[model samples]
Target: MADVRLFPRLAAVHARRLLANPGISTGVDPDALRSAAEPFVTWAPSGGRRSTNAELDRLRDNIRAVAAACGWPGPAGQVSRASFDAGMGAFLLESGYLPVAEALRDDVWSWIAIALVPDVCLWRFEGAAPERFLGGRRNTLQRLWSRARVFDRGPGEEDRWELLDRLTEDAMVQITERPSIGADPKLAAAIGEAWVRTAAEVGASAMEALTREAVRNLRITNEVLCFGALGDADLAAAVGEHFQRAAAATASQTGQASG
Candidate 1:
């Protein structure tokens, strides 16, 4: 993979317009969209240190090849989230962290989703929300990169992708998007382990309810606690306590409702 570079910041304006076009959201001719996007993309200094149009094409081709290899079929074809996640994870690892991180800007992602690989975006997102084209925690490429970065535990560790396998999509998104969790691998894994256990013990629906509460508790706890300063063991212990409390509260609510 080539080093990823960013387009000029002003390109974001044009990128947004392209994304806003309804035709692109449903699906557009990839070649046509690429042509439109070409004008807005301005490579960085040092002879396009940021990504070039050609690089974007290469990246899209690479994703398609990986998807095909992994059997992650497109919209008209059968699709598996597990296959897609695994394939994308491998791609991210190969792409290297620095270049991928540098290209994570909203504008860059926007251009890529709108022009480079809108089909993949539609396939992954089911052609629903515009966030797939725009930028956010839920942006297709951004989400994939963020998930891989957060859960990667290095060699000889548990496969972090299992978190995606276990958690509900909403749960995974909530957990992965938070700064405290997403930015720290150990912390994310710790919480993810706890969440998986909780889900297995209490069922997915109850676990999701508990997870919402846990997210709220995390926000409040972070106000006084320096989670970044804590070690893995300490963070896990803290999250464990919160999980227990949330689980208990969820159980109590369920009991009351049933009664």
Candidate 2:
């Protein structure tokens, strides 16, 4: 993947305003939007040799295909939404279409969300916050990319991305909302895997409590501990222990101990 072309912040803001315009529910035509977006595309700092917009086609087509199974947008079913997210996450990470460094830019993501696949974003989020359409942590696509990159089980494992499907949105929010855990892939995956195992053992009812406690505990511990320095087994064990303790506390509070 070469350097990415960015859509200007001004264009992203204008695109967001379009959502309020009546009849936006029908969705914007991607080709037309792409043509309109051309003037706003920026190559400041020389975006490395006349980049092509072919990836935009792939993104638009993938949105239709993925959204089709998910009830064609307009607030799809939860299961389908999650499935769609996982599919897109895999696409972003595996498609070889974007460089990781370039993908990190909020404006580049804004272009994709607004100009490339506004229909899908509008369909998925509907009346949700503006950030979902813009970029940054809450952007619909950016979060999925983060999830896939963070939870991938790595090269040697079969179905390396299984962890992405395992996480529920609430559990994810607890991790992603806190920069201490979400920014570090190894740490985030450790916490995610630990959350999954602990939730299973403690039952789903305790998951909310377990994650809350675990995130809080980890945040404080991370100030003194360097989880990044640990080996895989050690990291998992540490994360697992933290979750177990959180689960135990939750069980005690609710009077439903797993052990």
| Candidate achieving the largest TM-score | 2
Question: What are the runs in model 2 whose C-alpha is more than 4 Å off?
Answer: 1-27, 256-259
Judge candidate 2 against the unseen true structure and give its global Cα lDDT, from 0 to 1.
0.75
lDDT of 2 at 52: 54
Give the 10-residue window scoring lowest on summed lDDT in candidate 1: 70-79
Worst 10 residues of 2 by lDDT: 2-11
TM-score of 2: 0.85
lDDT of 2 by residue, 29-145 (tens): 766665666666664365544445565575568767877777775557778788888777877787756667667788777777767777788777776456886778889898888
The lDDT per prediction is: 0.70, 0.75
